[model samples]
Target: MRAYTALINPISGGGRAAERWEPIARLLREAGAAVTVCPTRSREHAVALASSAARRGEIVVAVGGDGLVRDAACGVVAGNGTLGIVPAGRGNDLARTLGLPDGDRELARLLLDATARAIDVLEVGGVVVPGNVYAGIDSMATAVINRNRWLPGALLYRLAPIRAVLTWRPATYTITADGRTRELRGQTVVVANSGSYGHGLRIVPTARLDDGMLDVLVVREGRLHRIASFLRAAKTGAHLDLPEVEVSTAREVALAADRPIPLCADGDEIGTLPATIRVLPASLRVLAPTAPRQSR
Candidate 1:
């Protein structure tokens, strides 16, 4: 029988993955799974390990945050294997979208017993993003969040974007979505697969994982206070109703800007933009909850 391989990031969850591994392993084994725990040395290493394990017909479980999950997804996509998640990472936003249980024991049980469902992922500039693709001020906030993994919980989530807003500036962004091209001076252009990011902020409130289409959000440049107000509105997904924000849906989106703008995928900086993102419908097979919590 093909065993389950757990690809764990040691630094994930502020280094909590190492502390949580033993019990997670024990639980899986007790549940009659042939578990092979793989501690990843680096992001690239995790992808390599997951890809290898999946090639052997084993289910690959990502035991960390969105970054590790993104890496594991790449491996699973490449090898055509099923993916599972044990949300030990800080944000666990994707886990939240999947309606994953808060408790680790329940999470482990779900991983071991759950059946696979196909989900859509974004193909952004050669990267496989299982969640959302964002740029501008939002990406800046994500950069801050990525740098301060030690902050933990509320402080990290609340403060990072606050800091990002202080240094925010708009750029001339040219965007083409579903063949509709437009240009604007904006703060962000987001293509969401799962919607929420930066610790549950609904950047694109209506985005769904299985929608077979991507939700694109645009926030044009505004006064500092207005921008701050927009950020606050985003928490309750009220930003979508703001006049400064525009929302659209498409199967593909291409973005470019006059200056080099930072880009992020699944809450980690992938690279700067001038890229095309397309939806791959029902391409990823993973263990997902039947009912996902709606972010609004």
Candidate 2:
């Protein structure tokens, strides 16, 4: 049957996503979708599969976590297809943003049933690089983060303070946004496309996908415990309310680093700095969740 299919990441969400294939397929079939299933074997494979699926004008639902969704996003954003999600991952960041249910089969039905909305995308560029992915942080941070990367999803936030303390102090960097420029010495600076990082952390909680603006947050020098305290406040939308956290809005932000810093995107590591970011408004069509999404 020629119908919309799901691209599943076998390693996502502890491989529980693969376990859900049968039920999700049945649900999609019941919803009048043909339900062709595609499994991603690697990063390049995901890109190839997603691009191929989008080329044929097929709606590809992400059946795994954010990494898989990001991979699928690379494909759909360039083509006529709209992307949907089933939140089965260590961090279902995008899924929560879309207000989809936790169950794979249920989310499939919900996405198939809802109205599609066009959302923005951030294309990050560095030196000769130009691509569609939000470089969340510098690459130096990615190295330090990867050294202790074996920790589970939620604990990574806890490790941030430790990384801040041990991985050397924050470097002074200059950032220019929309003809205005400033400098900051911080441990973490995030360029957010959509709100929510994962595991209930609101790095840029007030962000909106349709607003045509990118939100930037910088966590400046602070005690490790204080940094943890700040993350807690972010959970309830209070982190940016504090003096330690600085919030700014701009169409583009350029960062200058003495050395390449660590970087991350969607939920995985991309190459390091320097990074140039610009928001493309309403760049993608998405299946909005039926119910109201909880405030991110």
Candidate 3:
């Protein structure tokens, strides 16, 4: 992968990734690798750049947060090139979950020399949201997106799972899995494909990226204030042990609603939705090890 092309979002997270641009370029030149870096003008441009590189069989790197990575992943997954990350976005959730290094140089080495493996991602109508779990249901689903305003990192997240719990409650929604369909009221309906969502919060700790199945996390219905009460319960992942919380798995998921629900993919809130998501197992090639513990 000496001939490499990177699609970097300079404006992402206010140019955090761009901060390392020049030095990284210098190092790559010193390493005798041919490198080309391009800044994305918008969200859609990320995929356009990635798609162009994929068709050319070039090593494509995404230098932003999970949203940019997910966009690039969609572009390169069907092609023959490896999809890489630079990790400069706010959440960096996908990078943390994948056990990738901090920034440019480390990422360059990984792109140039590391072994690659195909990993699974949840594609909800062409948008790829990162993480292993899709928690909450219908109106409760909007609660997860609203929770993003909580502090921002790990310590804050220790308190986030419980945020707005009292103000929010489960809603009635139809769910289908393994050919079984039922109507249930729940606060969140999570689909887990990986363990944690950056900042070290594990919604589903045992998830695997290549398993070809999505782990489902369901929390039972509750009053608006009761949902807020779970703030403390979420700290230890005890929310899963609740009578309302149910775990299941499936190859595909479809969510339809009479009202708009906040939907986020890889940390970038796409829109409110009635949508479908499916597991594309071992779809995109990864440069790092198979699991978090196995990564060097």
The models' CA-based lDDT, in order, is 0.84, 0.67, 0.66
Taking all chains together, the TM-score of candidate 1 against the true structure is 0.94
Would you estimate the TM-scores of all the predictions?
Answer: 0.94, 0.86, 0.83
- For 117-215, candidate 2 gives per-residue lDDT tens digits of 877777774211111233323333334444554577577645654565565666676778887888777667777777676465767877877678878
- 1 versus 3: better lDDT goes to: 1
Candidate 1 displacement at residue 127 in angstroms: 1.2
Model 1 per-residue lDDT tens digits across residues 1-296: 33789888888887888676678678778878799888998768888888898899999989889989999998888889999988888888898888888776887777777878899999986678899999998889888887876786668777776788888778999999888998999888899999888777777888889879999898888754665576688889888787778888899999999998888898688889898999998888988777554543
Model 2, runs deviating above 4 Å:
126-152, 160-164, 290-296
Clash pairs of candidate 2? Answer: 138-261, 138-262, 138-263, 139-261, 139-262, 139-263, 140-261, 140-262, 141-262
- Between the candidate structures 2 and 3, which one is better when assessed by lDDT? 2
lDDT of 3 by residue, 183-231 (tens): 7776666677775563555666556777778877776665445544554
Candidate 3 residues lying further than 4 Å off, grouped into runs, are: 103-105, 129-169, 223-236, 290-296
RMSD in angstroms, all models? Answer: 2.1, 3.6, 3.8
Q: Give the TM-score of candidate 2.
A: 0.86
Backbone clashes, each candidate: 0, 9, 27
How many angstroms is residue 136 displaced in model 3 relative to the true structure, after the best TM-score fit?
4.3
